[model samples]
Target: MTAMSLGPAYSRLWTATALSNLGDGIRSAALPLLAASMSTDPVIVAGVAVAGQLPWLLLGLIAGALVDRFDQRRLVVLVDCGRTALLAALTVAVLTGSATVAWIYAIAFACGVGETLRDTATATLLPPLVNDADLERANGRLVNAEVAGNELIGPPVGGYLFGVAMVLPIAINGGTLALAAALIFSLPSVFAPAPTSESKGRIWSETMAGLRWLVRSRRMFTLSLLSGTFAFVDSMWFVVLVLFVQQILELPAAIYGLLVGIGAVGGLIGGFLAARIVRLLGPAPTLTTCLLAAAAGQLMLGLASEVVLAALGLAATSAAFGVWIVVARTQRQRSTPRDLLGRVTSASTTVVMTASPLGALVGGLIGREYGLRAAILLGVPALVIAACLAYAVLRERREPAP
Candidate 1:
């Protein structure tokens, strides 16, 4: 079926995901901005950023195994509920004047654990909700839910709300998670798949089943490597981005969200158009160009002096990111068997997730020692090298053997 035929279940799932994502975007922005208030030390500030991603590195493998073993829908609901509790506690902390960098770090890491499970489960949950032909289209809509909610609307609102009362946005973040859980609960019991008796015995073996496939697949492994490299570089660039914008570019704190928000327009557009682009360029060209975009966009932002150039550069980068994720996720789903989808998806994600914390640590140090300008410049060569390696891998795979 075409994307237009996506059923009620898929639509409901999408809505729930989008709602939570809106809240997630708010949490993602407000927390860092809040942490920034508690300390000027780039390491401390970047540490909170690291807390959010650290779980994916630590818990992603386990979560993927859990997703494959049990009901995905239930995991998502439980994770959302846990997030609600965490956000509520954070709101209380902020209102009570007890909010600390340590508190934020702990909460961020906990929430990230919830995210790692929910993300893998959600990806596994999706295929059952829609037809095979429309997976790409379905994924595109999901990306829009993420980009539009998280980056576009959420950040701008968060930037403004944090000024009114820091507690206000934190409270709202809890409420959204509650609502997302309620929506997810509306799904049928069939949403949870039963693991076959044979697959039940060993989590590690099940997990390894997916990893072995990834190691054996040139395309998936290469793509994962390329993505992992970029993930690392972007993490570093972003850790100090706010400081860069405020101090170096001299943009005021009030417009900070808008600065990131404008770039999200490219994400919104890319989400709408990724399938068309993939079809037009075909997977090889589409994947190759996405790498080029990553390198080029980072260079633009690093070299840009004025706010407008920076925004444009970011927009290009975000657009590329938007297309790249859709393409990667779509390729992943197409390649893996339905039974091992969770494990495979999680294993691949682990590679990308593993890099950001290191990047944050590095970015924090570089921005602290050299400057934010220098920190931003670091991504260019990394992405370029990744892009070149990816092109060679993709091209070489297509050539006829003797």
Candidate 2:
């Protein structure tokens, strides 16, 4: 595929996503650590994590439906503004010595809600902004930006800022969101109005149509299943990794950041190469192989005792995850009609992400009872099971009719 030049409007959207993602990355790392600092209860800290993800499970579909009807660019701006205010409030509360675990949980839940809106709109808007032939490359660029923002820049900076003062990271995160909001406001309208007939339904009926369409599509159904499974297993690892690094390995916070940052480098590489890899391997087979490789990497993590070895395993796992996401996203964009894209993507995301909170709950229990190492090991089997499910359910499928 030839390189497709995006217009100013599309470029602005991409810039906003990249910038906001960086803030999101910082918050993802800092928020949990803040929760941990607030309470000695493992379950409470884990609950904070759950709060952040639970909105995606419950409100994702509704958010998607709204995205389908509303102006996506304006919706994005609204969500970003909401996030900015929420984070700013949290920062102020922390600075004034008024913060508690409950406060953190509330803030997290609010952020999650805003994120669900922003993400659903962003996913649906991409296809309309760029040419059809440029989908893979555009997706690759977005993925690359996300990895750079989330993995490389956000976590490490958050870690250091947390070390200095928890309020600093929160304040910076809010500022980032504010900047993203400003950028979003400048984005030109990317979504065309939905067809008149399609827009003339009750909200519930529209939502059900989206859900039905998604479930009826063989490719989408398989992809959603695979994503949900992957998220479940990954959430398990995420919940345990911090404890393992801090308690078992006895590493400093900065060192933990370094390890995570290094692993994210693999994600960066994977994102950069996603389009090329998809072309070379074909989308379905390449995605399936990546899932298996992710399982293998998790197995290696389960067996690793040394920090360097564990980091390597984490890097490999991240790489596989990154590639799989890009391929899956490209396929979804290619197969789904633009009009139904928002609701369908939201429906699929909600179903798949439902496993995340459950996984986090299980991971916390296992980590507290058996140990963090064992909890990490639990992800190995989950990953393998997910791989098997993908191969059996998705690999033989043909593209769904649009």
Judging by TM-score against the true structure, name the best candidate. Answer: 2
Model 1 Cα lDDT, one tens digit per residue, 1-402: 333368888878888888888887888888888999888888888787679888888878767777877777888899999999998988888888998998999999998899888889888877777777777779988989987787778877887889888887888888988988987888777755564654576888878877887777788778887777777887888788789788888889866677766767878777778888977887767877877886788888888889888887787777877888888888777766666778878988998877766788899999899888888888888777777777778654342211
Cα deviation of 380, candidate 2, in Å? 5.3
> lDDT by residue for model 2 over 1-402, one digit each (tens)?
212256666676677778888888898889989999978899998888789888887788888778888888788888888888888888888888899999999998999999899988888778877787777778877887777777678878888899999898899988988888897777666565566577455787788888888888877877888888787887787778877788887878887777777777878777777878878877777777787778778777777777887788888888888888788888888888777788988887786687776788888998899888777787777677667777676666566473
How much lDDT does candidate 2 score?
Answer: 0.80
Model 2, which residues run further than 4 Å from truth? 1-8, 29-48, 87-104, 162-167, 199-201, 237-258, 305-309, 361-402
lDDT of each: 0.81, 0.80
**How does residue 251 of candidate 1 score in lDDT?**
85
Per-model TM-score versus the true fold = 0.81, 0.82
